[model samples]
Target: MSGTILEMKGICKSFPGVKALQDVDFDLRAGEVHALVGENGAGKSTLMKILSGVYRPDAGEIRLHSKVVSITSPLVAQAHGISIIHQERRLFPALSAAENVFAGRLPRTSAGLVDWERLNRQAKEYLDLLGFQPDVRTPVGELSVANQQLVEIAKALSMNPKIIIMDEPTAPLTDSETEQLFAIIRQLKARHVAVVYISHRLDELRQICDRVTILRDGRRVGHHLVAEVSNSEIVRAMVGREIVERFPKVVAPRGPLVLRVKDLSQKKRLKNISFEIHRGEVVGLAGLVGAGRTELARCLFGVDPFDQGEIEVAGEPRRIRSIQDALKAGIALAVEDRKRQGLVLSMSVRHNVTLASLEKISRLGWLRLGAEQEIVQKQVRDLAVKTPHIDQLVGNLSGGNQQKVVLAKWLAKQFDVLILDEPTIGIDVGSRVELYELINDLAKSGVGILLISSDLPEVLGMSDRILVMREGSLVADLERGEATQELIMQYATGSVDARVERCGR
Candidate 1:
């Protein structure tokens, strides 16, 4: 916390009928890792975009090092030593890691031709700094989500930027990878490079950030030093309320067993997996990254074929060979990556709403546009999806809005069982509450839900029973009354004491 490197004062922005930002104030200091936090559509993204030259402030002043500057484009921002790594990665899949890093500005030889050696060497150096070693020649298309995020960081660092804006950089990273990233941040701090670290993990901010700025509804709500703010205090400031008891479990009716799996295995990803989800109950699959939580979800949802397993839905064993079969069996899955597998980006809200159940809106091969609009409108209101209209493109919506659309699509299908993978990943405080209420309502209506999420608090809050996973294996099965943060963590990381005497046993 020293001299200020960048500042934005009285920033204001609007889109159509919505005021995305209003009179926001923010500043970043040299040699400091400043954190910016807010829920989706809270104006955090909009304000950062203005600072990085993606959007011009409707009314404001930007000063860099005591002198004002107008950033008209991304290139201009880069020239002024500012860069942003988006939450949704924008790397080209067809290119190699080295190529993606040096996409626009590749090294050239004397004749102005490509210099592969220099490009690979430079990319390898950055990758090494991030504790990653992969074939630079391999295309980015083959890399996992975590590895792809590292490439994004490498691209930002390649610019030798004076200020780097990281948006949810740790969303895809595992625990070890996240620690490595923190180490890299410390190295950047020593080099006097200002970093704007944006993430939903409040605890991580307390550990790494020098200062934090909270944005709500596109306005600066509060700013405080990390040492002066407690986690509960920060949550109150962000959501304007106390979030007591993060995981609030209730006694469910526990109707008939809706889903049963035995010997479920998908080659190497899943092995001998077995579980049962009952109607009017919420079963949570808790685990760290790459612990087969998502792999099991995919297997259950028909995204991946099971090498060997028997699935019994509603007490009848059946084969879920494809997504269509899963739908026919009344299984609805809000995928982990909603943008990638859950919703069609290029489609309209109305189209996506009815996508999973075209039969409901189709009459004898003739589309009923009026009937479709009515259903779409009902879901939009039911789920509180923020869109200009049903005709609005899903791609143009915010992350939370897009997620709501996916949920709406599934709700329209009237599934008996719903599998939500990270349903509230990037949503804001208010929307998270809304989702919780919806899930509770669904459970009351006898819908069996298998909730998979990385947020420990959320998993604990809404689950009737919790299952901990580690390295593709189920480590513990704890009831709601028996679960605790420490106990769940121990099982999740494989620290469970097998020698301990069981109280009931």
Candidate 2:
């Protein structure tokens, strides 16, 4: 409801073998939250990068307050009153939270020396506004993922920019932290700061965004007022088709148990965890942040050691003290943080996909090139991964595509059970549907799945059974027929009675 503050016209950018953006147009009005959305590799991030001076557009013109200007670098963009919180964490891991927040703009004393005390106080003030209470002196790497995200928000706000870009800002936050962020956005609106919000979570658009622009295949396809369009319509525009079923959960014949965990306990991270996944069944793991969902996944995958537990794969108790042991036992885990744990970024798609199945493709420790190529080609085609070629670096692909590569690595091998931790996190609606269909297909193929996610609807729609965790303990196990968003939240937050029938105990 205010005058136009920013406009980009005829934006065109290209990468080797990829046309990232093509003549795209976008505009922003002061005091409004405008959303940028699309499927993976749809040019959303590329356009934002251009605007934030991370990449120079091959051809485009930017007008700010009716005057044309060139943004040559991040420092220039900041000087022009622009700041961005990237989807990926960009803070210095070894630096203290306060130091990272005021990296280039640290306050100085009267003598022109570094004012450490004032810097910490100011950083704490910004973090306090977002309801985060980590010690300012602590290194950012020591903080949890959710807390690190809060630090990113605080760092962006320290610049006092006129236009702020948020890319998937809530992917790592809890419900309360997300609400606190919404409160801060409202305050930014009251102060007339324009916000460009980029997220794969379309539902948030209706709640926080004023308008939205949808792109697909490097082109601007649709733009609309948030209130005037349905989420389905937006999905159609982004994917160019009707997603009839977001979760195509097919009920396969439940066979014998494939994975069983009994009396699993860790040092204050997991407490007597017990669960079972039958062949061809999908089990949903639901909980808030810090509920030990990820910790359980890590323990089962042998990324971390457990104090006491028994893991049974196909009725055979096995000791999984390392990742190699877990894989050898037919247990595969698609970790929560794919960028760090699941896939090697510097590796090529061909290499990452076949990294786990080298033994199958090799004989006498000599990898057969023909077998390797055949496996990677099949997976690339089956998953519909949009890459120039299998040789492309995993880091060059979009978030969703990278996630598919992670799954492809595990799928390349024969496994009895698959643990997908946050499989759909930071992924677009269209990509999510593809993943859901893939899950259904995998279940139909008799691979038991353990799905861990914060999206309650995804759990309700895809799982035959839901497991809820609270404070490092399994509290409730509800069948799909009896589970609802409200009930799951109650169990996750411990608002309801914590006593419940423990499955597989």
Candidate 3:
């Protein structure tokens, strides 16, 4: 490692009934990317929160250049040249990109008025430096999630901090966009700025990190150079066991068709989309960011009403124009944005897990608390959700645990068709493998699954069939053995051979 720039000793923090961190220690160098990785609720975020003043550690000593300092708030941390990019973006949707980037520290003219021209110009410079050139004057809400990630990075760069902490920075980024982020990280490193990179993706650590720190059950278990340890070693340290297969895709004869879509269309977003999901099979959706994959999912789940389409549920034509209709039709959707659309952060794990099937836990305007507890307890145990208690707030749980809660909510139902949008988006490798096995188990149990993800290998490994969406339309349909990474990418990018089929039937 290079010269030590910061260190934390005996860091400890606790919430009401949960001890998030306990005597944890960490250090950073002048020009190195240190990766912090662990399973959900393993105290990775808790430790970083303490360092960034989101939470004050119960016991810890922070020394910068060998001088002990106290950081009691986010402003104090910022004053000490520390800035953090949270995993969830905190931007004003109604504001423009430039306005979001230079929100708090806007330039002022000599007359004591805000200078819009200089603000947009400087924000554009940062955006271009990061290889993101969205219209600065446009509302950020209109931009894609990947572009919003770049804007978050631009906001961090405007801070001119000595240390930058990125939490799951590439969770929503595509392959090319991720590479652009790596380039920016390297540039920051060359300027002698320390970066604390946190993510669940192990391959990213191998490519961009210098040293890796492993956390499990709120304790530091291993710290080693990326070159000294194999990825398997880190996985073992994270989950306390070996994960042989990251994607446990099963191969079995599929049953009868459970869902069939014909000529599904929405205004400008989806066009002539058609597909089928059979019982005991997993169908993967592959496409670029704006290729209408999510739009199709929404249409199926009744989140977005399709302009024209024919949907067949278990050999019977059904009209699913709303959530109630979809639920009655034996269809469900575990949406892509877990934080925004799926789970309620202000609620408890117990409440969230039983949200979808509240009718089952209620009796004619009366509530059955005992039954709800039983149902939620089983789900927590099945999903291995790490929490002090079932009553713990969902917001306090880690990203992986929150996602599990979302799944638990839908799994509580008896739906025959399930649509999982980005099922394993930001989860750890161990959790990803567990989810793959879960999906396979569901399929084996005669449940049809529609899996959507941006990861190419994930789609190729777990899916029994792949459906390629391009420019709001279904472009290709390939069976598991017939599909290849290159072939899917070609179809997804809208440059494919004539051999690829354009229709589902």
Candidate 4:
């Protein structure tokens, strides 16, 4: 048998104004974890979609196990022992976990009814294989995002496919969940399954991937064995530039406290979280996944109501009951999930950029098109947002550009304080640097910044002070000079005592 399980040669795909993929070539081997990596819109996803039959390649030849094959549809791909786990999961929320797992090919009884017992049994077996134990009969909507992702993986594994393609599988998972996933990948390797792993986290890829293929601007720029490639080299190949420093920290003089959260507590998530951010200062919220960082931001943004708290803005007590009220109170939030919470994909880039401050671009209760365009144009230039034009749909832009649009939307609105939750999630290394620069610039402009992220290095590098959260409580406050990876991880993983022993003091 041939060592290769899959291969695509000279693949080319294009959208209306963008060449998504241009003459890209890729290959996968049996029992190997091959990583596909690139900047957002660097044609990584496009090439993977073509391989999985989600998108028909404009021109290419796919060879399966040393033989040329045509993959016209997803069913055809599945028939050939191929499966793809999408970043955005497509689970049936109303159905039970077992039912969703055995959605299309459920075992049936002699009378043509689904065998519920067998269904749960099979689903439980699959979950067990991944070191997970959830009630198979329970509805999928009730499960957390990380659990839902595991269920998706279990569903894919149940097919007993020879090739499995996973995209950003660990984006929403915790550290433990990520470890579990790595274990599963090892098991798949033992079974000789060819795994294609796609992720933006270069460090994790080094830990799990055996080989890597990097694409840039729809072309396969480089491919190398993981042992021979460094993170900086991969980053340079993906972005076509050498980044001198990962974090660009430019400290501005701190001013008086612009906002203060006193005893902020939310149901089941945040417990008496108190912090303060001074004007022209970046305050970091550091924690593990599900550590109430996002919950605290949401409460402050009025997306979720807090049970008890006092919010003082510019030395005045404010009542923020909704997002509208928060905006009017000179507070802006750039949410974590850009697709779900930040941008309306169907709208044009111009529309999304000016969405928050429509009143500023309106005359006599009507939108001024020229004013809106000028604002968007300036933001696009300032942020270096790469798009065809302002009239282009936001949905068509890549993840990095979409995030820039979200930033632009908030920038258009005049605000005293800005809260950013995981602002660099899934973005490329270069784009992350740009975002850091933008944050520094904003902080220098006297905007109090609250940066919430699980990336410890990012928090330590960018913040003036870091506040650590455990479970639902604020456990430690560390100045930038005192914060280290060891100290942060000790608190984040709950290995250190949370009795407020003055760790970061």
- TM-scores for every predicted model: 0.91, 0.95, 0.93, 0.92
List candidate 3 stretches off by more than 4 Å: 356-370, 498-503
Error of 3 at 312 (Å): 0.7
Candidate 4: where is the Cα deviation over 4 Å?
131-134, 356-369, 381-384, 493-505
lDDT of all predictions, in order shown?
0.81, 0.88, 0.85, 0.84
Counting only residues 3 or more apart in sequence or on different chains, how many pairs clash (N, Cα, C under 3 Å) in candidate 1?
4
Predicted candidate 2 versus true structure: per-residue lDDT over 1-505, tens digit per residue: 5999999999999999999999999999999999999998898878988889999999989999989989889998999899999877799989999999999889999999989999999999999999988799999988888889999999999999999999889888878899999999999999999999988888778889999999999999999999999998999999999989888778888988999999899999899988899999999999988899999988898889999999999999999998778877877888777655567788899988886434453343334656888888888887778899999998898777888898788777777889999888877777777778878888888899999998889999999999999999999998989999999999998999875566674
Candidate numbers, best TM-score first, in rank order: 2, 3, 4, 1
* Ranking of models by lDDT: 2, 3, 4, 1
List candidate 1 stretches off by more than 4 Å. 241-245, 356-384, 497-505
Instruction: Please give, for residues 1-505, the per-residue lDDT of candidate 4 as tens digits.
Output: 1288788999999999889888988998889999999887787767777877888999989999889998888888899999888776779988888888888989998999999889999899888776666788888888777678888988888888899999888877778888988998998888999999999999899999999999887788999999998888999998899999899999989998899888888887888777788999998988888788888888888889999999988888999898876876678899776655677888899888876434453333334566777888988877777787888998788766788898888776678999998888777788888889988998999999999988888999999888888998888888889889899878877898764544222
Which 10-residue window of candidate 3 scores lowest in summed lDDT? 358-367
Residue pairs clashing in model 1 are 39-428, 247-460, 247-461, 248-461
Candidate 1 lands at a TM-score of 0.91
Q: What tens-digit string does per-residue lDDT give for candidate 3 at 167-260?
A: 8999888787889889989988999889999999888999999998888887899999999999889989999998877778887579999999
